[model samples]
Target: MLRRAGLPIGPAEILAGAEALSRIELGDRQQAQAALRATLVHRREHFEVFDQAFALFWRAPSAPGEAEAGEVELLDKAPAAARRVSEALGGGASPAPPKVEARPDMALTVSAGEQLRKMDFEAMGAGEIAEAKREIRRLALPLAARPTRRFRPNAAGRRTDLRATLKESLRQGGEVLDIRRSERVVRPPPLVAICDISGSMARYAQILLHFLHAVSNDRDRVSTFLFGTRLTNITRQLRHRDAEVAFEMVSHIVPDWSGGTRIGEALDRFNRDWSRRVLGQGAVVLLITDGLERGGPEELARLAAATDRLRHSCRRLIWLNPLLRYAGFQPKSQGVRTMLPLVHEHRPVHNIESLRSLVETLSAPQSRARMPS
Candidate 1:
């Protein structure tokens, strides 16, 4: 009831209130008990703390009388008082709590930081991917506000609107003082993310999907997609108020789970279909994959060329390769070598720290030159 009455009471406050009640002197025990009970229910605010204290003080088993036992049972069965209080406080019925669906306990048990150095990307499964994605979401990024150009009325900056200020001064009894001008500050560009979810990319997809969900909800203007043999737009699905529901929807939509990858075909389709649509307003593309092309080098080169075209369209193009997690990583594959040169940033997407680094890179300006042809 206190919560309903908009009174914030912690556990300590409830206990303190109970203690104070217990200490009240009784000239007549019956009268004092009646007065206390009346005080407890005088208002909703009183009932909230009183209910909690009563439950604690008179354990159902110890409380005397049939009425007291019935009250205790009612309290035990009381449809979570917090929800009622919240509703009464004008918050409405509390939102239905998320359903916790039980999945097999198949989570990977890698010790923190111990496996960061030697973790192999190819070895992780769906369960590990989910946990890894959660871990990645926990990683923080150093977000720096972009420099904005604000308009100023003073000649020291931009030209002052002398006419408006003089008019205002005249309106203030001809006083040529307290002149004011307005300025518009430019907002920083929104962050754009384009993630790849394809066949060979399936092992890394779940974690990245979680990462995409986090980015979508936490930041503004995020676009996501999944592609195996074909491209499936998942931007709308990830917009569900609940992340789990969004992902479940995505899992249902994406048909090529653990299927074959066609990087060139997917990129070509994206270039034709989504690039002009979602790639506008200075977005960043995060092309994630191992860069193994079954379509051979020609198609890989064509996709690489399209990726380069995408690079021109966006503020940044980053390539996140799980293969880069290997200490002795090399761009031996033709597809990798072809695509690497086109990206503005290249980083590993294997673990939490790597994801953290990716966020940091997104915020900072890159200094590295494009990889040599």
Candidate 2:
């Protein structure tokens, strides 16, 4: 059962657990738990799952009426951890309790982190969001490194440096014994995030800024901008070491917050002012928005022009639209239609799973990403 919960309980660990139980008094539940846990639980995070599995697998069989008293309520009010553990034991097999409340403490509290990883951001409570922020800070953006024009000295490099080889041969009595080689330098591309802070996207934006803040502090030459009515360069503001202090600085400087979106105007501002400054060295741009433009047909032309220019300015222009969460999502809005074709990829950003996918995509193989039109 613990193995089903994704615990690393191999045959060796099982044998060890059995041997551990032999050393402790079987009648004392606490001693047995501690011994098994000491032998089987390799990770601290797996302790809860180990405890729950131990309780279920080793508990004395329930009396005739005792099982009937709480089975329905336990399943109904089960927390995410309990639900995960149940999935191992054939969850969703019973159609019984639709609204029964279970005991929180006694309920299996396993897989909470797994549940959190898949949870939608907007649906999360304050505590969950806080937990998520800590998780985000721990993430390392897996940005692939691109080969630069300049070459560096390397013994295993393909290209031979004739000049260096000759110089080194002088030390060997003018004998060209070994040819020195050099390889093109490889460096991770700069990352720039242009996020929407419009009323509709504010909640997702709030969460993404935490992610961006972590990214900004993690590496060098990362830039960030916030756009609603106009584009506000937040690269400087987000550079603060403290996330809370950095966001406070951004909140003070940015004039438009949770306001109407101006897709065309914001892109124009980015293309004209910041493109040349930051979009150098194969920069990867993350354009986050919902694509619900409030502009007219005329503005759509400008939107198309700006998006095209921005796309040309960067190596990869990824559109992280929260609207893509919908199953039947389409580029029906003027803004999305104008921007979608210009981007290398159009992906969702509504949940943690999507965010993790984005991280994976960024760290993908050197070849640029190309999503379907």
Which number leads on TM-score?
A: 2
Q: Where is model 1 more than 4 Å wrong at Cα?
A: 1-131, 140-143, 147-184, 366-368, 371-373
Candidate 1 per-residue lDDT over residues 1-373, each given as its tens digit: 4433223333544565576567766565545445455543433433544454434344455445764555456446543443333334343343585875965354755554556423443333233334565666665543444434555554343546677778888878989886566554544454545555544565467667777777777766667877777788898888776878998898788776555678777888888888888776456678888787767657877888788787887777778888787778888988887887788877888766677767777677644465332
lDDT of 2 by residue, 1-373 (tens): 7655545455667899899988889998899889989887765555665665555555456563554344434545444444445556553453564774866663566577878887877545445767888888877897888887889899999999999999999999999999899999988998999999876777688888999998888899899999999899999989899999999899888877766789889999999998999998899999999888888888888888998999889999999988888789878877787788888899998877788888998888745667884
lDDT of 2 at 210: 91
For all candidates in order, the CA lDDT equals 0.63, 0.80
TM-score of 1: 0.58
Model 2 misplacement above 4 A:
1-110, 155-157, 160-181
Q: Pick by lDDT: which candidate is best?
A: 2
lDDT of 2: 0.80
How many residue pairs clash in model 1?
A: 1
